[model samples]
Target chain A: MSLQASRNISRFWEWGRKIICVGRNYADHAKELKNAIPKEPVLFLKPPTAYVREGSPILVPLYTTNLHHEVELGVVIGKGGTAIPQSAAMEHVAGYALCLDMTARDIQDECKSKGLPWTMAKAFNTSCPISEFIPKERIPDPGKVNLWLKVNDQLRQSGCTSQMIFSVPYLISYISDFITLEEGDLILTGTPKGVSAVQQHDELQAGIEDIVTMRFTVDRQDH
Target chain B: MSLQASRNISRFWEWGRKIICVGRNYADHAKELKNAIPKEPVLFLKPPTAYVREGSPILVPLYTTNLHHEVELGVVIGKGGTAIPQSAAMEHVAGYALCLDMTARDIQDECKSKGLPWTMAKAFNTSCPISEFIPKERIPDPGKVNLWLKVNDQLRQSGCTSQMIFSVPYLISYISDFITLEEGDLILTGTPKGVSAVQQHDELQAGIEDIVTMRFTVDRQDH
Candidate 1:
């Protein structure tokens, strides 16, 4: 799709900043990707352009032929702070939502081979699709939550947040140690295993336990 | 260093929202990084938290035993717009500066192993050190500007923007295609060869041909 489709949704939450993501937070996903579970949290970024509403169509760019879908849980920042203690991180969270961290596996692979950056592969248009906000208080303990995603009603990924290698508090603490978290920011917890490529017209649905669900479709664009 | 050391540079002009970096933008760096020169631009992000102003103390984090410096010319966005044409790209530029894209090579390597996101390796605190602003009009042709960095009086990285894989306008056009450029956002046009590690207390000096020069020191703290 053309750049016109890339708009920042952060304004809705008063978040005028970046979306930080945690990678391989789940044990199964790490093993499936053939990566070792880290002792600490792993962090990454998804530019504002990547944010797409849950109902929007995910455009498949013509440049790369292999595009994949990664279903993740998104944490919206309610306040901005630095070096926040793990015990106090929950106070900073505004809400939660189900998100998809789409990737161009081929392009990312090439970049990895050359010791390069992953922005093009991760921060493209419609790369992230998120559900409406679910206030943090509703989730009680995010770590115990169950998340699942299905394509055309066929289950693709099903895992509980309990399987995450790093807990929510740890991620918040670790991230703040590196960068200051700001209002309207989002932290996309890594996806569980079952990430795979999708074709045009594929109907995707993702849900977080009894909390919320999101539905979307893939489309092909001329640009 | 503690979060207290995070200087509040909230002036929209002073705080760059995102630092878009181009990897393998230079042919030699592509070779040194052991990857083929990409047919298209390789993009990545270094968040605003990574930003360190001219003469700001760059604290070497304890987690990264091997931190390296990547000196490159920086492009500051003046006007924020999307789908900007190559011819009109310069109209959106605010200024230029000298910057260091600091990296935690070891952590980045680990991320490369598990196909993880590069945030921990790239978007760390004090990871970006930038010189004072030099308005775009000052440097008639940013593509031809010369950039270099020195540590404690020893020259480390020296290169010219002429060697870039994507010209300034092209980069602006390409980045805007997916990510919308905002006022105060910085685009780090990739680094040159001779990137190496530096120790605590080392002095770093970087500059662009005739525009801006910056001086800073490495800070080592117990925390």
Candidate 2:
């Protein structure tokens, strides 16, 4: 039960740790979804078991009919710390990755209505599809990169990191103040305006500026 | 970054993994809190950093004032499995522990009102305090055992496992169908009827039947 490091930059970093995520960081995305613009970063979580590599297919849970793909920039933490200051937050980053915050939108809505926890909605197996790590040096300014996602070759989401209301360093510092950010932990910066449902067999592709690109196929769970 | 096992039965299990918890499993507790009796187990999470052992103080987060104590029975998973059947679920049991799901009740209510995630309220550092492990053999009838918690020697909660709407085996199987249960992972069965706020310096004691008992002191964060 040891948290193992990614053997190389090309390998998927699948260590068993927490995946902390932000919601509605993009104002346009929040408005489109009819959600109030949060003054602070909206936080949520996905278990480590949600990790699925590039070649693997993202399984649509049997209970969800409206599964959506959210393209986000993922910051991988290299060092662990508590109460990290924004000034030194970037030093703790190991790299960046293109991640799809695959969500069960219908289940999420139901949970929201009932004021229940979103575990079953956000933490199913294969719920997080991550691309290979891009060293922090490659993306000198994570705050200004372009990210986009396409479903079946049609562009569904397109935005730049500049559109984010909360910067990576601020999110890192804020999250660390409460939950200790550990090595191998990941921070999902949040999705942009375009988010829509995907069907089984849909080919989903996402990229972050020309540095990293990944593709995943959606499949229905037979169970 | 390896998930280490407890050094001995007397030590706290400090694996870096998810602490999956059930909410509103006790009918009386749910009624008392004015929450709907969930048709299914309400699930939430706490990060590995939340684990604090006896003798150490549970740090009340700076953001919370009405911090409540929820004493629960924790089931520690021994074997890892997915889509496991209920009949075979017991084989996965490594042991049990007495746990307090320390919660920020005020923050939790606000989060619930806004339909936001409970990470800041539930996953903060020292939000969970657990006693040493209790071997499964020591408590043959997990369903019939009694658990109680006292603050400053004043009994605040007293109930039996029979009050749980969802049994341990069913919860393990149900959760595994969605989130994979790994060795060293823990499932916190929901708390019983009585729950109240605690302030700094409050001495908390909780136990499961006569098998295991633990004491903890609450302290306010210096920050």
Task: Quickly count the clashes in candidate 1.
Answer: 2
Write one digit per residue (lDDT tens) for candidate 2, span B34-144. Answer: 999888889998888889997789999999999999999999888889998999999988889889999899998988888888888899989889988888889897788
Go through the candidates in order and give the clash count of each. 2, 3
DockQ per model, Cα: 0.35, 0.53
Clashing pairs in 1: A15-A184, B78-B94
lDDT of 2 by residue, A1-223 (tens): 3234322433435454778989999999999889999999999898888899978899999999999999999999888899999999999998988998889999999888877778878889898899888888999999999999999999999999999999999999999987888877889999999899999999999998779889999999766
Top-lDDT structure, candidate number: 2
Q: Candidate 1 residues B17-94, lDDT tens each? A: 678887778998878867678888877787777887765688777778888899988888878887788999999987
Tens-place lDDT per residue, model 1, A1-223, is: 3222332333433234678887778888878867778777766687776778855799876666788888888888877788889999999887887889888888877766655667777887788888888887889998888899999999999988888888888888878876888767788888889988888999999999878999999987444
Candidate 2 residues lying further than 4 Å off, grouped into runs, are: A1-12, B1-12
Proportion of native contacts present in model 1: 0.52
